[model samples]
Target: MSETYWDRHGIYGVMAEFEDPEQLVEAAKRTYAAGYRQMDAYSPMPIDGLAEAIGFTRNWVSLVVLIGGLTGCIGGFGLLYWIAEIAYPHNVGGRPFNSWPMWIPITFECTVLLAALSAVIGMLAMNKLPMPYHPVFNVPSFAERASVDRFFLCIEASDPKFDLEHTKAFLKELNPEEVAEVEK
Candidate 1:
């Protein structure tokens, strides 16, 4: 590809390396204050308040799970009702036409099963999981540093305020060891 193509679409973001969690958090705060959205931070371990500093508050996985559970519950109950009352209409030893008690176990199981699956699938989908490749992986410095006792903050090129030179200068001002441009 030509340099223009690389410049236009292949650059993912600019990343900076910090040695401490506090430094990373401060950098994220500064970057947020500088009006840069679409940023992310990675560290060897979770840092307290990092998500808040990065302006992440809402999560929707629980809502997905709730919807799944409700669907499962209603479907399970409806299936049992159709089987006993309408599909077969069996008179199993003078029992009630619709044995609500018998449906309890199956309904509970379905609810749990669907809720668990929803939690896992919704979380993975929301987080963009199963990601075998990413532009961040193209940054050689990130591969060695991000996972081994170093914290990295990346301000993505997709951010409205992202300018190659300006963002680079801003990251440099945060006193990172290196401010690297990540290729897609």
Candidate 2:
């Protein structure tokens, strides 16, 4: 038998589609109330209050940025200090050994460089980028409407409260145009 890649770590759950963005928001709220956690929502455009409805909390992007910036500042200062004090210290024109003003430019540049690099890397890591494959792509009819005029909500099988029959019935209650099973 051919090995099924998703057999072990697949999202086998029910999906709900909604016409009005408000309905989707309400549905998400109800889904959360019903103890569902591993679920996601899709819409043609941004929806107000939808994140709050689904109990979505802010990610750690800001924290990551702050830490990166601080680290960069410290690293830059440390590098410049080491270079000026120890490595080939040149007392040009009898200036002090620890020339604070002269080192500012390089320190500033290094700080900016490291902070920018960290922000980029942190964003990619937080969002789980470079994901080449996802099970949502397997939904044949789903692709057409996702980017167009429809909204979708999916509850994953891995959720603690996920039950095949119960989840399907709950989705049907949301009055989606169609409810379908998604694998992986």
Name the top TM-score candidate. 1
- Give the Cα lDDT of each candidate: 0.89, 0.80
Superposition TM-score, candidate 2 onto the true structure: 0.82
List candidate 1 segments past 4 Å from native: 1-9
Off by over 4 Å in 2: 1-11, 44-48
Which 10 successive residues of model 2 have the least lDDT summed? 1-10
Residue range 2-100, candidate 1, lDDT tens digits? 234335777889999998999999999999999997899999888899998889989798899999899889988999999999999999899998989
Clashes of each: 0, 1
- Pairs with backbone N, CA or C atoms under 3 Å apart (clashes), candidate 1: none
1-184, model 2: which lDDT tens digit per residue?
3333334656566788788798899899999998898888888899998877777898677777777777877888888888878887878899887888877787778768877787889989877998998777667657778778888889877776777788899899988888888877
